[model samples]
Target: MADSLATWMPPLASLDDALLRYLDQTGVAVLVKDLTSGRFTAASPCAPRVLVASQDIVGQTDAELFDAVQAVALRAADQQAVALGTAYAGEHRIERHGERREYVVWRHPVPASGEQGPRILSCWQDVTEQRKRDVLVQATLAQLEEQQKANAELRREMQDNQVRDSVSGLYHRAHFEEQLRREADLSSREQREFAIVSVSIDGMDQIRETYGADSCERVVEALGRLLKANTRAMDSPCRLGGDRFTVLLSGVGLATAHSRMEHLRKACSQHIVAFNGQQIPFTVSMGVASFPHTAGSVEELMRSADRAMAASRAKGGNHLTLASIQFVPAT
Candidate 1:
């Protein structure tokens, strides 16, 4: 009769038992717990090596092994899964053998028969290395962003220093020269028109003699501020030297340059420097020159403009002169 009963048993049940044994021998841990009682009902032999205190937790709740907060959180998660009739999978950290370890956990509800109540099956795998890798990746990304921001700030500072005048905080002569060369090259290559205007302040030596060097510096700084306020973005205004300024205007002809110079002259006439409660009025003489119409090369163009400026000063200061009228073409 016993043999007959054994023969009647299905092969699937035997296969399941064999599979469970195989998992245990292969070091794969398995655990089953009563949902209502919160006690472990089944624990494979391999569970002890993989999970801390696996043998002691067979008939105990999480409160017996973990802190009250962790136990409460675990119970809440299990209750939620049982209520929803679904599986819950997530990562968690646990203190085991005086060290904190990370684990990947999966929780599933198992339906029971009439004699048995519902239970939960909980499975876990160590993921400490993976967690560490994720932390490292985040740290690396933050570091890269910081480095990029620093590099951008440095580039902006360098550009600002390159364009700023050392003495007056205005555009310097080097910047203006570079702009003139660039514009001249563009004009010659693209057949476009551009203009250069040069201005020389009158009576600078008289001002220096009357006031100290510091006062002279103050006047120059004030003039620089005025030029910056008056010039457009397309116009490069620069302090060429003591009492000398230059402007490179893109896409402008000689006539337009002359008109712009007149406007600058009017603005300068209206400007007054206040020192020690005294107002000092100043005058400027300017000269205008256009590319291809005056002369070739930046140096030659500047020379022609200088000659016109000399002519304007010879005619008694505070005037705008066109270099084209006196421009001599190079042979």
Candidate 2:
């Protein structure tokens, strides 16, 4: 293709080594032409791929490179670019080897003097593959959006499970377990005692049957409020699932634990949870245990508190009891 234009173009002029290197290395087709002389000067190696203009294109004018109609249109565009003294670019469709393809072309005017006359530098980029890639990008973007939404939902569920109870806004069982371990370690290291009080709503199965599901939710909320109101700042309160709550009272003895839990029970009994225009009355049973007094280890403390709570519930609902477990070593 370049061989054809070699004849129509003028004799090659002195060219810049860097410009030739740039054209050779670049992916697109580049060319230099003297508009005033109506002749081609230089072409990048990709000239054969992009320029199907004319094979016999050495000293020939634009009129010679293309047919009459195309020659006329190209000349008009060139004139406009030269007038602006800047690159004029646009997408163009042309037939090559019996196939029509799209190319983005730029015509930049280069000011020249003497015999060099006014020059035009040009390049053409094939955008067929680029269009295909753009479509794929849109599909990839949609897939990424879906993945992000799924990840967000997974994060929310994980957060709900780890730190908070979905219904009551209290610390859940996992948090309580972790806090218990930390508190036990701190108590042992400081040679101090902390109380573990286990509390559970009395006769929950009966209450749920009598008042329905929402009633249970309301009762739990009211109970959470009561715990918050009665417990001190250092206490760690948690919901250990299904109407059961436990508190780790830092630096508190068995007597203080009993007083606090007894006060909490009275408040819980007096407070009525209102739901759907009905006043729902509920009560809780509490069991208290202390480190090194009632139990030796975290497991022992939890078991002792649970046992005491169970005893309170067995006797009747809504009572607080102390579990007396003297720490004894094996013989």
Candidate 3:
């Protein structure tokens, strides 16, 4: 059987002149489709213009005008709209003259008069440029968010580098002091106790004299690595210059703090510094002081820990000492 719509349509002389003229002059594209035959019965002059085609579109099905995939989509929508006797509205993409275009289209189904069969009234508006602009805007927004995230990460890295020691990769003296003051304030306000452990290498001066400056520096670096390895994530480890190190253990007592430092001391005693083919032995004395148990203020706590560490070093090198609390008048 013939598939051409002209074979189903009446003679060209029977067309309504007023309607044809009106459609020719109208800028909007409109079409009437025979739902039973699945072919266009009539198309306005503007319909051909919208498709960038100079030939008449009356006999052309979507399969002739578009690729197979696009035709299948359009046919499905048209069939459903006609079956339901309702309006269809959607976006459709098609390739024309080797370029892709988007359209906002609507199809309205209506019963045909007498022998004309079922009909579909369809119209489309070009929306290709608008969709392209929307895509570009979304891409730009995503790039901006990524850039902001990178900037935030860079700022955090720079701040960390500023407060880290070059030799030990531990907190610098100023950063350690800042943390000390913050912990002291927290402890006072909450009436909770926290511990601070001070560490010093025993006979460091004698080791420097015997091993030379290079060996002494290496020993300091080694101790810094050991301390960092032994401390917990919540603990703040700091190198306070020379052979001195400190750890601020938040929410811990003198006993637990002393236990942790004793393990570190044991590690240090077993650690060997091999230089110039000679094994050099080293050990650290640690002093533990708690906020309410040892002193009230940061300055007093530091002094007590320092005095205890000095006492331990004087007595024997590899020992841990607990500081006795000193009374001070409330300010």
TM-score of each: 0.59, 0.51, 0.72
- Comparison by TM-score, 1 against 3, better one: 3
What local lDDT does model 1 show for residue 221? 78
Query: Per-residue lDDT tens digits of candidate 2, residues 3-41?
Result: 333332243334454554565566577677788776777
Span of 10 residues, lowest total lDDT, candidate 3: 1-10
Model 1, runs deviating above 4 Å: 1-33, 36-88, 91-105, 108-164, 169-175, 226-235, 255-283, 294-300, 307-331
lDDT by residue (1-331, candidate 1, tens digit) is 1122123222213425565567667555566778778887666666776667644657777888777877887888788778889888866687877878777778887787465578877776767777899999999999999999999999987897888876666677778887888898889889987888888887788877786566677777777777777677888988888888888888888998888788878877787888877677777888888887887778888888888888777877788899964447599
Residue 175 miss distance in model 1 (angstroms): 5.1
Q: Return the top candidate by TM-score.
A: 3
Candidates in order have lDDT scores of 0.76, 0.80, 0.81
Q: Count clashing pairs, candidate 1.
A: 0
Instruction: lDDT for model 1, please.
Output: 0.76
The ten-residue window of minimal lDDT in model 1 covers 1-10
Give me the runs in candidate 2 sitting further than 4 Å from their true place.
Answer: 1-162, 327-331
